[model samples]
Target: MCLLNLIVRLSYVDHTQDVSHTGRVVELKNYVRGLLLDSSGPLTKVELINHLQRLGVGYLFEEEIRTVLDAIWKGKDIEIENDLHATALRFRILRQNGYDASIDYFNSFIDEMGSFKACLCEDTKGLLSLYEASYLAFPGETRMDEAKAFAKRHLKDRKGKIDTRFEEQVDHAFELPIHYRMLRLEARWYIDMCEKDETMDPVILELAKLDYNILQASYQKDVQNGSFPTMYYRWWRQLGLVEKLPFIRDRWLECYLFSLSITYEPQYGYGREVLNKVNQMITLLDDTYDVYGTVEELELFTDAIDRWDTSAIKQLPEYMRTSFLALLNFGNDLGYDTLKDQGWDVIPCVGKLDEIARGDVPKSIQCYMHEANVSEAIAREHIRGIIDETWKEMNKEYVTDHVFPRAFADAAVGLAQRAECVYVNGDGFGRNQSNSEINGQVMSLVVEPIPINNV
Candidate 1:
């Protein structure tokens, strides 16, 4: 109904070329489902499930995959294949999919010294499987810890010594285990890898490629349509943050990708857009506190944010007025939207958070650095350990029911994962908005659509 909505969002992605793509996707999906239904062996079923998941079309076949996995999730080895690679792959996939596949299943391979037999070192696929699954272990799984160490030490040594094709995946898994990588992004990368894999099922691969592009188009449209970031960009331009403040900058893509990492399902557009706004706001406040604001000025800004009132803006510095007012407007808009849709006025729930008290001012990394009197590197290691611990805790929570919406819980974890991704090598927000890691990730997720070629 507005001028902004009038501007179409073609993004050079043509639907006419893809008119048959929709039909092909449905056709291939049914074929894959039939394979799941007819597959006679556990090995074939589990392997197909992994391919579906890694190729990103697994979501399309969730019901079939779930039904198959439920049938295959017998905790005993009598039903599963006896080999290390098959068993380890099943363990990792099952655990990841929320089944309590025990780490004890791997005890048969451990020797008297509690070390994984050197025989496993010769089994490259088995070692890779073990290495990946070890990361999924909960706290106090010492055997898994040993498994990781053993697998990692050998995998690194055997890196280039194996088949060139598998080595590509070895390098990928070594950089970051698939468990930690966001799904949609990982799928983009894996789709290419799966395409190159000679044994990959053609129908399934075609479905993955097509479904990815289809959902990707939907995501891009979300970026341009109702509750649009393009609309937000226009508002941001109107805000004149870069011009007036001369420090505030736009990070719409990064924020959107961060939100997508939270949960990329097309149905979660409202939640994704809202989460994008939250990320953008965090960027602005982070810049104000860390890059621009003086100690005294930050104190004033913090107080204004705490008060959540226009009256406080009267006492603030000239440059601070617009940022503070914009923050208030954001809160008000969210409150208004919540009421209009849900019939519940949540303005009362609006409250200022992150009022760090005294010694609590030091966050995890800083706290570890000061408390242990360790180098920054060591403190960073300590923080990574905390992240790993938190993940295990979340893994425990993930298997149980929670009161929070699934999206909320997912976004909470995704927020932490985004921080890790953005800041992994260095500032993902900084460095000209391009790095080999995030630049490639963003391109895969948003910028470049997968080529819609024939299978």
Candidate 2:
């Protein structure tokens, strides 16, 4: 007879008698067996307890269930799945008669133990030892070792004697997660600033906003595809906005490394190599701007820096300070190099062509005329001087009369056209189009006009 049938039979001694505590024990065994059989595979201890509670089983003690499970699994009447850290057991009734008989006998032995821990205590360690064991069981999951190293610098507690396991767990959890979280928050702040800053150009701000949204969407897709954990993906998606904000890209990379340094031990050679590459990129960007960018470009750069303005330097976080200082030094070095390269001379002014043509009836605007086509250096120099002088006298009045009014009229016409397009596309007037289809159509209309004389 099978062990389950034997137990069921044993539960009722006389055929007419009332069912006793043995029947209750038999019922408990049957309950566990039924749950395991119904499951696709093995169940965790916690899952098994939850299953029993849900089934309305009375007098169900975790310890008692654990004891029965262990015995049934050991006798090969139940198969135990090998997990990463422990065995997750499942019952299979129709395996072997001898196995069933052995399990039935072992079940009685377990019952004599008075409680589940009487058997469990023989194999497992005490609370503190179990805490250490938990860390050892999954080294990747618990960064307690890293936390210990970090705490050592601040704590008076001696090595190997500090009772800060629980504290370390909590701290490590947030420490590893918070850096990326802050990066995301800061990225969002920069994106919002682009939209709201009065000094910022609308076109540039709109581009930054688009870049922010694209990176965020890509990060989220990667997370959903399981390339990273949801927590890491969510944090990284926020940080992805950093790339869209001017001057924050390098700072974001530094923050990324700072966070990594806590969870991962830096191998000296590899770590140094990566840091050197990052420094080189920063140097390259500095050189590119110094050699190529105009004063107007520098003004934009300065504005970006000023957006994060703070009175006290110490108020910035340590990692942020490190990143900002690196960028600041790069900008300062570039400024000095640019000044030296230009022989400390001021940038030459380009004057108004219309004003120059007003005083001297030149065939065409001298400023618009290319220097390359000028036959002699003397002629080029004379033309440039006349343009500058004429600009100093009448450039402001000419701009007020011609340029400002024309620009306002053109802008008004463009806005009206855009409004019509929006209305035709079933969108409200003045509502900014986000999709590429509408933006592309609007951009098509912004093409430079060909000369009417050529047409």
Candidate 3:
């Protein structure tokens, strides 16, 4: 599915003072800044930098982190790296941050048979670091390819054999690499993970908890009042799609999550709201086209969308009429705001990823199932294989291509990553989408505030 991009350019929340905790947060920020700027060793520095990022406060110290990583990348080739963990961590931080780190650094760990040194496998921490670093590989990087397979095979063999913290990490890496997780959600999970680590700085954990809760409060205010999406749910209720149509999922919260995942930085508040609206309308369109409409009715609906006018309203079915008018009003509202605020006129749109019922074309999984006459399991595997292959291509292209604005390219690629995270288990946007895993994820990231007293 294509991404919904709405840009009204604004500030991200990094500079927004969480007023209640202003003194405490400022104290923590300066303390952490000292830790970064202090003369820490390579291992400690990377660990601190990574903790800053996973804690969701890295953006506040971007210049510091950049200066640190830059010095690390350009310095003595990390000649002081004493083990696989340090080597892999250094390699990943450098390459991942757009430095031209050489793959040859891994050569020392490889033997004549092209396999990693067998002794290295016993170092679970090193293996995990290698596993994570391998994700930075561009296409044809055979060393990284081998590193991933080798590390994954051993990590599976050693699952419960590791410490609690590393074991939890290994389990999650298998479920979905940290590379592919939605950032805010991962930050939430990582806060708890760090809390359990004995070596984790209590100050950092405090900042993480307070920062996450503050951001969650801001996001919830933007999305809803409490458990319900009251902000624009009223606007949606006024449209009466859920009441009149009954088939479409009431997914205002999910749409907001999708928008938030796409543009999580606080500065993109306007863009996020606009994108949220675009996602909701697209969901309505997706449900209308995929689940309810007949081919002939869909033809009329598509035509109405194509015509993009008020008169086309009379042609749609009664339920479809409500959704169509909502779409038009959405466009008109966006156009009005953009014109009034920025002197530019624009409308919004989206694409569907699932099947279009019995009459229209089948999606990838459906086609696989129909062709192979296999169970849904087989079909899903085939489809995921396709997604994985395409991910590699996307991975390669993003690594090698440097022609566009990095932030824009990052957001473009992030849409695919975010979509994968959403549908990892199944249809995350389905009507009955309240599974515990998904719901807990939603609560942890965008809903429930972390109880800061313990941390």
Candidate 4:
């Protein structure tokens, strides 16, 4: 027969028993083994084919051999796991005898079938298969949008009356909460889209503004209804802003929850930045408490502050001198406090301030202290006061503009890194087209120029 026929016929016979089979099979196997032995770790399907051609296997079609090899390699119960493992085994053989027997026989079949898309689309269930493949191929926001757009178009074109329940379910999938407590989510998404996407359509800003108004209205209604206290506390807890307001014991858990969200969500830029500042504040507060306040006194103060009890501030132990000082500094920096006497929820603690000043207060606390404006002196004092000598040594100039800005920039960089890594794992279309498009949209939304006039 022909060379291909001879090779195929030889494959069925045991090499040990048949001299002719032994010679041909040994020669082909050695050739493949040698190719893999000399190279690096994993070769792609194309690389494997070219290597086979270079081996001078006249009868063996590289594509056909690749198909069989790939099947044997990827299958769990096979003698070898996959091409990488096969390549390793071949490498070992080459080191011993200057030949490799490892050849991927399944790649030829794949080449014959052409691209993954063509094979997927050739089936009778073309549309469903295509969608399923797309879902498997692209996930997260990219796939979600595609699926939503497809469903919306499909439903709109249908002549029959759509099932209202099914339609409601579809709408609910994309629905976001509109209450003031949750409006931050929408704001975050809008801000991220604006910053990250180069071609972010301006129309999205209109939607965001409308949503902001709705949330504001809801908040006002809740305030009038005397539900503001509960909702406000809950919001603080959920957004992790409560760590800065330690007196609010009822919402401590909520604060932790919000902190976790801030860590993960790139869209929560404002909240995230604020949370980092709050973390620094917390460290400073803790340091003050350790130096100037007893644990019992601090605990009691926390309870009193949450209750908005002005009198309890007077009852603070002699050791709890720095507690009120820290609180005052924090209030000044943030521009508002629940304890301000003029507000509806105010509880005047003026006398308590006198007691704190009597303690061993830092001079910077007196000079850099103001509620209206934060001077460079104040910023420097705060940074130096909190970061000890060791931490300063570990990361010199850690609080300078270069280092501090890293926290802010990390969200954008992290998103970009994740997108790039995920794209690398996928097909060319996903890598080149879909992921690039998504990244473009994200970058446009995040870094879009803000109109100075609007500000």
Give the clash count for model 1. 0
Each candidate's number of clashing pairs is 0, 0, 4, 46
Q: Which ten residues in a row have the lowest lDDT in candidate 4?
A: 174-183
User: What tens digits encode model 2's per-residue C-alpha lDDT throughout 87-197?
Assistant: 211211111101121112123213353322233222211222222222211123223333223323323223244434434433432332211122222233444433443
Q: How close is every model to the real structure, measured as TM-score? A: 0.89, 0.15, 0.86, 0.20
Which candidate number has the best lDDT?
1
- The candidate, 2 or 3, that scores higher on lDDT is 3
Q: Write the per-residue lDDT of candidate 4 for residues 1-455, one digit (tens) a residue.
A: 12223224323432232244335455545555454444333333323432332222212353454453454344333322333233333322221111222223223212353322233222222222122222111112243234324434443443144455433423332241111012133344444444343553333333333333332233333323434323433443444433554432222222222342334333443353344334334433444453545567767766555544345667676444344544544445444443353354322443233334323245443445554268766765574444323322222222224544544533333332332323332321213222443333322222222231231
Winner on TM-score (3 vs 4): 3
RMSD of 3: 5.8
- Tens-digit per-residue lDDT, 1-455, candidate 3: 10111011112223244686767888899999999999878678988888888777887798998989888877764444658888888877776556667778788898898889998878898889899888777656878878999999988888778787789899888888766777788888898898788898999999888778777766655543222234455677788888898888777667767877777776677787677677777777777777888989988888887777889999988878888788887888888888899988675332121122223346778888889999989999888867666765666666565778667656766677677787887777673655566566665665457887786
Name the runs in model 4 displaced over 4 angstroms: 1-266, 305-308, 317-455
Using TM-score as the measure, which candidate wins? 1
Model 2 residue runs over 4 Å out of place are 1-125, 135-247, 250-270, 275-455
> Judged by TM-score relative to the true structure, which candidate is superior, 1 or 2?
1
- Per-model C-alpha RMSD: 3.7, 35.0, 5.8, 28.3
Ranking by TM-score: 1, 3, 4, 2
Ranking by lDDT: 1, 3, 4, 2
Residue-wise C-alpha lDDT for candidate 1, range 268-333, written one tens digit per residue? 777776777666666677667767878899888878877777899987899988888877887789
